[model samples]
Each structure stands twice: as C-alpha cells, then as structure tokens.
Target: MKRTVLPFVLLLAAACGPRYGMRVPDKLVEKLPYESRIELLESENDLALAIDTVDEASNEVLRARDAIRRAKARESAAEEEENRAADTASREVAKLAIEEARARVTYLRAKQRLNVGLRDVEQLALRCAFARYELARLQSTRKAKVEGSEKLDVKKYEGQVSQCEAKVKEERAELAEDSAQEKTAREAWEVKKAALAKKTFDARASPYVENL
Candidate 1:
C-alpha cells in the first residue's frame, strides 16, 4: 500500500509544475510589449527636438532679412536727402549768376551815358572857339575902317567885316543852342548814372545781407 501511494503523489506533482512554468512565459511576453512602447515614445521625442531646431534656424534667417531691408531703406533715404540739397544749391548758384549779369549790364549802360555827355561838351567847346575867332576878325576890320586906312580897299574891307559879323552871330546862336542841349544831356546822364551806381551797390551787398 505505501509504494502505490508514493507513485500517485509523484504524478500529481509533475502535472502542477508544467502549469506554473507556462504562466511565467506569458508574463515575460507582456513585459516585452511594454519595452516596445517605451522605445516608440523616445523616437517621437527625438523627432520633435529636430523640428524645434529647424524652426529656430528659420527664425534667425528671417531676422537677418528684416535687418537687411531696414538698412537699405535708411541708405535710400540718405541718398534722397543729398539729392535735394544738391538741387537747392544749384538753384542758388543760378540765381547768383543772374544777379551778377544784371549788375554788369547796368554798369555798361552808365559808362555809355557818361561818354555821350562828354562828347557833346567837347563839340560845344569847339563851336565856341570858332565863334570867338570870327568875332575877333570882324572887330579888327571895323576898327581899321573907323581909323581911315586909305591903302585898304574900303568896300571890300567893309563887305568882309559885314560877312564875318554875320557868321559870328550865326555861330553864337548855334553855340547857345548846343550849350543848352549839352546841359540837358549832362543832367539826364547824371541821373541815370546815379541810378546805375545804386543798383550795382545793392547787387554787391545782397550776398552779404542775405548771408549766402
């Protein structure tokens, strides 16, 4: 009876050991699934870090482009300002040149008037000299006639004196007329010259007064 009972107990123990070994293999398979999930999560995190780095690089590039654009705008504005200044300076120079030309013209006109007046005075003086010479000749002949000069041709001398006196009177009237004309011309010239002088002075002083 003891030998038969020992054999039956050994068979039962063998059956229970097979069942427990099967459960251990199943648990190891479950742990493998969890390890695979953890690996997948790590890969996703690495992909996100790569994307973030790319975004940062793109932002830097955009910032550099904006800086370049701003610098170009500033340069263009400076160029425009310089151009405006140059245009203004050119206009000022043109105005000054025109003023100088006008001044020169006024001076020339004044000089011409003075020259005309001087010429007229000279002509009047010449005419007066001629008149005085003719009067002297007529007086000499009349005095000779009154002194009874017998050798001299009386009719011829008297006729010559009369002709000379007439010539003297005509020359005197012409001289008087010329003198009056000359006086008028001189007065007009003086007035014009004074005006011209004032214009020249003003033109020369304008730059100083304007502080140009």
Candidate 2:
C-alpha cells in the first residue's frame, strides 16, 4: 500500500498509442433553465462520447479486416497462413479445430517465442491489489481538509478503488484462462507428436522385418 505513484493501469493508458480527439462543439447544448440545461448538456456529452467510442471501434475493426485481406492477397502468402479461418461470427467455432490457425497466428507465434511468465502475472496482480489498498486507506483517513477544499471527492476515490478491484479480478481471470489454454494445447501437441513418432519408427522398421 505504500506505493510511490498511481497504479500501472493509469500509467499504461497514458503511455499507449495516440488516440483521435473527439470534439463535440459546445453549441449543441440547448438554451434552457439552469437545471434543464445542465441535464441536456450532460446527456449530449454522454451521447457524443458513446458515438466517438463506436466510431473508434468501427475503424479498428475495418483496419483489422483490411490487413487480413492484404495478407491474403499478397503474392508470397503461404498456403496455410492465407487460409480464411473465420469471417467474424465463426471465430469461436473455428477455435475448436486446429488445422488452420489463421485467427490465432499471433498466439502461435508468441508460443514459439519467449513469453510472459507466471511471476509477471502475479506481480501485476499484487501491484493492483496494493493500489486498491492504498486508495482505500486514503479514503478512510480523517483528512477532511482536502475534502473541504473541494479537491477530494470521496465518491470519486471510492469509484477509482472499485475500478482497481475490478481490474484485479479481470487479471486473475485472464491469467487462469491463459494458463489452462496453454496446458491444454501442450498436452494435445504432446499426444499428437508421440503418436507420429511411433508411426514413423514402425514404418522405418517395417522394411527391415520384411528383408529378414
């Protein structure tokens, strides 16, 4: 709980790639009574934010689709790499079969390389938990002077802590899921490889037996 800075989530968000600015003109707010105008403005802001989010997500999807198409259309496209494993709705179904892992090419590539270890996952989870603890400690402290100055909002701090806890839960879930998937994949691969080796050995020894 005695951390020196904000949680890594906030820092990571700050360090991530640039995002398109979503500017909604203030002129969209209607002229009305104080309370009614405030309500209208808030609603307009929420709608604008939602619209921006959808637009960004749509653009991302389009970019991903286009990239896949380009990869498929390339002259040097490998046979298995260019397979249209799934369009969109069939991705979940495609995962059940392992022949052409077009959608999971990145995962396969990472599996072939050095990847994050369990210790990293545990460290991140611990840091997030500590961040939540620190937030709770701050909220529980008797420092009302900061609140009196209109700088500290108890509700806001509580919300931040809640978000941190949710993140901790999410990290744990993802870690568990990834670990299970890795174990399953390795087990299946081992079974297949052992069978293939046995068949190969038998084939090589078959001609010798016939000659004898």
Candidate 3:
C-alpha cells in the first residue's frame, strides 16, 4: 500500500510541475508594461506584412489581365478555325477548343477581380486588428502612469483614449463591410467558374453522345 501511494503522489507531482514552472514567469511578465509593448509591435509587423501581400495581389491582377487578353485571342482564333473545318468531327473538335479557351478567359477575369477584393478585405482586417492593439497599448500605458504617480492628471489621457477608441470603432465597421464585399465577390467568381466548367464539359462530351 505504501509503495503504491508513493508512486501515485510522484505521478501527480510530475503532472503539475511543468505547468507551475510556466505560470511563474508568465505572471511576472504580466506585471510589466512589456506585454502591451510586444502586442503593439506585433500588430505593426502584421500590418506591414499585409501591405506587402496586397501589393503582390495587385501584381497578380495585372498578370491575370494579360492572360485574359491572350485567352480571348485564342478563343476568337478557335471560332475562326471551327468555321473553316470541312467535316463534322473536325468542327466538333474546334468547337471544344473554343469552349476551352473561353473557359480560361472567364476563369482569369473572375480570379483577377476576386484577388483585388480579397486583398482589400485582408488589408482592412489587419488595420482593424492593429487599431485594437494600439488602443490596448494606449490604455495600458495610461493605467501604468496613473498607478505610478500621485499627481498624474487623469483628464490629460481622456482625449487621446477617446480618439483611439473612435478609430477602432470606425475600422471595425469598415472591416465588416469589406469582408461582406469579399464574400460577394468570391461567390460571384464561384458561380462563373461552375457555369463555365459545365459548359466546357458538355462541349467536350457532345461528340460521344448519340441522338435519342
């Protein structure tokens, strides 16, 4: 009985030991202003990264536009080829080629617009999140000052806090609207892709089907 009880106690101690060790430093850090500072820095870093990503997305939209132009040319050429084909099988093949090129153009155009909307949403989301961290840091610093000094005038911080709060609220609203716009854009792109995919598939399979 004694041996069993000792092992059980040791097992429980091992289970709790790591968590206790972790909590001590976490609690110590929570007492300092460094946590809020780190949060603000991270938010800034995220916003900067998001801006770079938006720029890349813009470049992709340009590339997609170029591809779309090439695809349209291919589609027009396929139409002319279909007109010149002398036999039924040859015409069917050219028709399928036209459908494929048309599909590519449709996909590229929708994707270009979707990328633009997504980047706008992403930038707005990061801006909204950064504003929250900024407000948190401002409030934390104001609290620290009030706690550390007996003569600190609380009214001095109110104006700055109010402005930060207003900024956060405004960005939050804009983020919501931007997210909705992105969702609508994505849905529209999906609809276009689905319709084009069905059309292209039917064109490819038409030669294999027998008349009823």
Q: What is the lDDT of every predicted structure here?
A: 0.39, 0.38, 0.52
Instruction: State every prediction's TM-score relative to the real structure.
Output: 0.25, 0.30, 0.47
Name the TM-score of candidate 1: 0.25
TM-score of 2: 0.30
- Between candidates 2 and 3, name the one with more favorable TM-score: 3
lDDT of 1 by residue, 82-182 (tens): 45555675444434333433333343344334444434433333233322322333334334343332334445434443554465465555555445654
Q: Is candidate 1 or candidate 2 better by TM-score?
A: 2
Residues 42-85 of candidate 3 have per-residue lDDT tens digits of 64455456456656877876877787788788788879988999
Error of 3 at 133 (Å): 4.5
Off by over 4 Å in 1: 1-151, 202-212
Model 2 residue 71 lDDT score: 32
TM-score between model 3 and native: 0.47
Q: How far is candidate 1 from the true structure (C-alpha RMSD, Å)?
A: 64.9
Q: Which ten residues in a row are the worst by lDDT in model 3?
A: 19-28
Off by over 4 Å in 2: 1-130, 133-151, 170-181, 196-212
What is the Å distance of residue 41 in model 1 from its true position?
A: 99
